[model samples]
Target: MEATPQAPSPLEETQRSGLALGLVVWVFSLLGVLGALYARWAWTPHSVTVEGASIQHLFDVILAIILVAFVLVHLLLGYFIVRYRARGSESALYFPHHTALEVTYTAVPAVVMVALSVAGILLWSRVHAAPPPDAFVVEVRGEQFGWSARYPGPDGKLGRVDNRIQRPFNVDPEDPAGRDDVTSPEIYLVVNRPNRILLRTRDVQHSFWVPAFRLKKDLLPGATTELVLTPTQRGEFDLACAELCGVGHYTMAGKVRVVTQQEFDRWLRQQGRR
Candidate 1:
């Protein structure tokens, strides 16, 4: 009698099971993408919430393109691989690059990239442009594990601050700026005014990050850095220490309260008097 055709062995069966699992995972991933798209569409904030959220439209456009491209490419590749897997007497055919295909790929990506770059530059310029003449200035000082903020007391001029001459809570007697400029740990800002933060650190490198405003800047020891932000929303936001300093890094946090101009003035006066 002729030999019966051999059935797939246990090893082959196991291989098939793994392949099936991989396909199932890919399918679930696709479903997850759909769910994410729905969530993003439903949850995207129309009114900008943070400084970075001002460019939310641009970000959404870029993200949509990336997500769609990824899903399409993966699905097509997986389908082709499964449909054209190796079989007896069949071989794979490779095609050389076509100039039209190459040009289309390169030009499309180049255009998209250029558009994104231009949008980014425009947004950056808008964000960095000098504030209006009526903008407010607040001096921000970063130390080992805490943040202190100082506002110009009614004069709109920050008097002076020298770390070496100034004590923890006391101003120096000799230096003019130190004598006049006062520092306070409680930071208060007025709503509807452009605010500029002059950031400085005393001990080590630290980053002052405010998530609600989407503003962050690194404060270097012995040097001053600056950040300008406008709080459109009036509320409270937690300040996170973006950089690692030492043992208490995890506990280093601050509170930011955006209040009405009247409320801010009241608080400033109360804090400064003490």
Candidate 2:
């Protein structure tokens, strides 16, 4: 006796195609997630400030949780897709929502969100609070394409700045405190010392950023901003306007050199007191 063969049914054909599509999606998603993780780990910059280090640590903690969750979810999804995949002549099961499962999902995410918020606020408070009373002071005014820095003279006090005093550039020449201020093309500070920087803008808006210190603050027209930092490393770090201010935004660049107290004093003297 010989056996007879029959063609696949429409249902079987649909099931076959669905499984193929599921496998392709799973493979591509896994690859994409892995590639992103590797790239992020490869080129992150090193932090030179204690505050930046703390922030980076928090970021790492969050990233680790995210990566683990990502891998687990994708794996579980792939497993279910294959384990309970559609088959010809199979009847679907009816299932209803479970209150316990729903509550678990909602409560877990809410708790995680609250924890992250509290941690961020605590970290911000440590870094953004008032600077030490004896902290070194510096003033920075950003223009369309350049940065002008001022250091308090012997009196150790910055002058009262009135942006309206001058148009393109600002000053109150008669404000005696400002008369002896020293100007520098780039900002400089003493390593391991708290620094209070009073930021101003000459024309439009700009951002004063120090990547190594993880510090960035906007410089608004006719408004003053204060930024505090305590650099723990001695090195020349790059600064740039994080905001787009004008046609020269791409060329807007500055550098901050964190040096020893002796070197900072020497640098101020070289600039010549006004």
Candidate 3:
């Protein structure tokens, strides 16, 4: 009797395979969730602007929703795969219709999408709204391999700029408003003060990005764009072009210095003198 042992049935083998695959999927899904959690907690950059915290919060909310959906989807998929695996002499079940299920899935996602869209629109409106009357103004010009900043001097008015003028800051030399404009290689912002930046490009398209500020705006050739922000921290941060313009794209880098109002004023005065 002991020597008459037989092979396992096909049904038993199929169940075992399904169970193993399901377990693998679950394990991988958990690992992915952990990795994302770790990245969110440890790798996220600090927000240094007044509006950056709100932006980060919105991003975190989106990520959390996505992760929740991801986990639920994978878990359900694994369960379905294991529960519905083919067995000997067994046929798959077919449903003629599932109205409630269909409506639930469709409505839930549609509602969520609409909610997120509204939130994004509100945030965008607030961020791009007209700058305060006393907001500091600066012009950021992008060129082939570098960045330059122009500040309105004592008159507090950025002069007319003609792309064809081809001068520093493109200031129309004849425009009286541009007579005291100050140009610099780096952008200087005043802490706790609203700053309005006018964006322009000399050639190809470029993007002005400051990670700490959580702000990025595209600079299109022959057109002007604007970005407004209020810095809450006083420090130097890296500014880089996010768009790839040409071979020298990687070399398009600059500095963003945030300082106290007094310091910013002194720096502007010194630059104007030079």
Clashes of each: 1, 0, 0
Supply candidate 2's per-residue lDDT for 54. Answer: 90
Question: What tens-digit string does per-residue lDDT give for candidate 1 at 1-274?
Answer: 9999999977567557656755875787698788878867775433323355766667778888888877877776666655554444556888887899999989998999999999989888887777676777887777778888867666666665566755653345564544445567777666667878888777888998875565578988777788777777787778878999888888879987778888977777776678
Q: Judging by lDDT against the true structure, name the best candidate.
A: 3
**Deviation in angstroms for 221 in model 2?**
0.7
lDDT of 3 by residue, 1-274 (tens): 4786778788788889998999899999999999999988787679999888789888899999999999999999899988888677778889999999999999999999999999999998988899998998999999998898898989999899988997876789888989988888878888898999899999999999998888899999999999999999899998999999999999999999999989988888888666
Question: How far out, in Å, is residue 12 in model 1?
Answer: 8.4
TM-score, predicted candidate 1 vs. hidden true structure: 0.82
Error of 2 at 140 (Å): 1.6
Order of quality (lDDT): 3, 2, 1
The C-alpha TM-scores of every prediction are 0.82, 0.89, 0.91
Candidate 2 lDDT by residue in tens digits, 1-274:
7776877878777777777766876897789777867866776667888788898888878887777777787777776776667775677886798899899989987998899889999999998998889999988889879998888887787777776676223557777887667777878888898888888888899999987788799998889898988889999988999999999998999888899999988877877734
